[model samples]
Target: MAVAVNAAVTLPSSKTSSSPSIRFSSIAPERIAFSKGVGYLKNGLVTGGKAASIRAQVATETPTKVVKESKKDDEGVVVNKFKPKNPYIGTCLLNTKITADDAPGETWHMVFSTEGEVPYREGQSIGVIADGIDKNGKPHKLRLYSIASSALGDFGNSKTVSLCVKRLVYTNEQGEIVKGVCSNFLCDLKPGAGVQITGPVGKEMLMPKDPNATIVMLATGTGIAPFRSFLWKMFFEKHDDYKFNGLAWLFLGVPTSSSLLYKEEFDKMKEKAPENFRVDYAVSREQTNENGEKMYIQTRMAQYAEELWELLKKDNTYVYMCGLKGMEKGIDDIMVSLAARDGIDWLEYKRQLKKSEQWNVEVY
Candidate 1:
């Protein structure tokens, strides 16, 4: 991440350095008029008399309240309402395994009773602090999990928040079994069990307000969390303020068909809105793509590369990716050649999409 410094400075002309002169066409003429000695600069040096005049002009012209007002209009994106030092104690309402018993690992769908105390939007995450102390003699650190339910929640009420968690259990180099403290705690949770929770953090994966916009979701494993929330809002629920009339296409990758999460719910959604929803599964072990290659998300996506590229070219299309960070590289590889077909630079195009908030990513 790059930290932006807010300090303002006037650089000397290109004659002072080996670099060529660069023009900043976006800067307003009046703002840089100081270079002509009308304000602060006098022969590349700040003049006290002119500096005060420029400061007065800036103070009167700049919109000091723009940032504050923009935040106020931001559709209520909630953040850390509960902190680690003082976390919210909520009760688990339900904890049921969603994955098949014979699947590679255990994945559970748990809903916590917030009782309207902990408000959250879709695509946000909650932090869970496990009950026990760690080897360092300190309390276990909280683990963040993506919220699986919409703002209306799993019960179609605002009192609950849900999560999709995969239990982490593995053998260490010493041949000892190790389990993830927070994940195991969440997975084994029973109804009425108290859970220490914090945060409804993150804004990157928030759904766009454009109700008719096309949504392209790419997920792997439990990365399906946020997308499930989005799909529920788009298909299963009805809102007086919002209606999704456009397309939502999902590509989910998993090791086996049995590991597919929320299969029944997604199937029902597709049945209800057949024209508006489409789903593709990439089961690496059971499915193969064209040319007999193991079916992965990117490979399945490659089948519709042309159609996807066209949709991506539209202003109302949004692509969201969440899962393992390596999935990004696979997507980039798929898009590179397709973008080149139209003489476009894929990286630069993707950057513009990000700048416009059209391409959203939340991968670990």
Candidate 2:
């Protein structure tokens, strides 16, 4: 049995770093502007000076008051009352195009901005509304995508929210080059395209706030986006604090090495938390499988079941699953097998996960 000698080394971000006041602000207002103007269209409701300017314009056009009054029924019974919430209502843009991949398949990375802040826990997703009708005269469709950057990276002082997207290719009833409305429109977008989007939903898949909690991230394909957001939230913004004592592990599965997103950033994260962070690459087409078939994270989990189980057994450990739709079952089954080998009941293991909120899966 070979026990890996991985010594922990605390990076500069750990000391007084968890506090934003301590960590040297990475994204300045200027950088935020550049990201909003140049990068993804960003979310539409993020609050900041940039968004405030837009809201001021809207207020001038629409004079609305926050009225607080109780509605009375037949006997003067208070039925409903209007209570003011945040006062700031987010505005959505319709069909705003930002960036596109002009390949055979029309994939995209669009952005939008908002008048109010749309704060989110890392790994949360949002809903998108497509434009126009399909070839079959159906209304535009809706899809969900995870936020690739942190709220701190894009909101408050920042002006944009970024998203990683893939165009859906499907044949409509007309048998023409019918494709997904929103995705195709996004794919054809130039720099100034715009669209409507709402929300930062999903409570099940969220990063633990405790800096000491370990994060085990597993994803395939574009599923890497939310993990990237989590990585940056844990490593980049909080780097100087030396406060995040948690171990961050990333198991990324892709078709090929070339298709691996954020390779450079992953290298940087490893350099920052050499012992505290570990990344496993599962390239199905590029690497030969030990079982003589295409490799995946499921197979990798099986190969290192004991170690994976040990990592899961640690205190304050969190598991996040993303990417392909079927991975949750495969990973869960592997964990169950490992639990059975350790004389732990599968049902108890699940209860433990629920109690600790250790197991978090987001598949689409």
Candidate 2: list runs displaced more than 4 Å: 1-107, 134-139, 154-156, 170-178, 239-242
Candidate 1: lDDT of 331?
89
lDDT digits (tens) for residues 1-364 of candidate 1: 1111121324335464211122332232222211111111000011245433332332323323211121123757778999999999999866666777578998877778798888887778999999989999999888999998888766555777889899999999999999988899998887679999999788888887778778999999999999988987887666788889999999999999879988777776778789999999999999998699999899899999988987876656789999989889988999999777776777877876775567899988
Q: What's the lDDT for all of these models?
A: 0.75, 0.56
* Clash count per candidate: 0, 38
Q: Report the CA-based lDDT of candidate 1 relative to the real structure.
A: 0.75
The C-alpha stretches of model 1 lying farther than 4 A from their native spots are 1-75
Candidate 2 — worst ten consecutive residues by lDDT sum?
A: 1-10
Cα displacement (angstroms), candidate 1, residue 132, comes to: 1.4
Provide the lowest-lDDT 10-residue window in model 1: 36-45
In order of appearance, the predictions have TM-scores of: 0.80, 0.67
User: Residue 48 in model 1: shift from native, Å?
Assistant: 35
TM-score of 1: 0.80
Query: Which residue pairs does candidate 1 place in steric collision?
Result: none
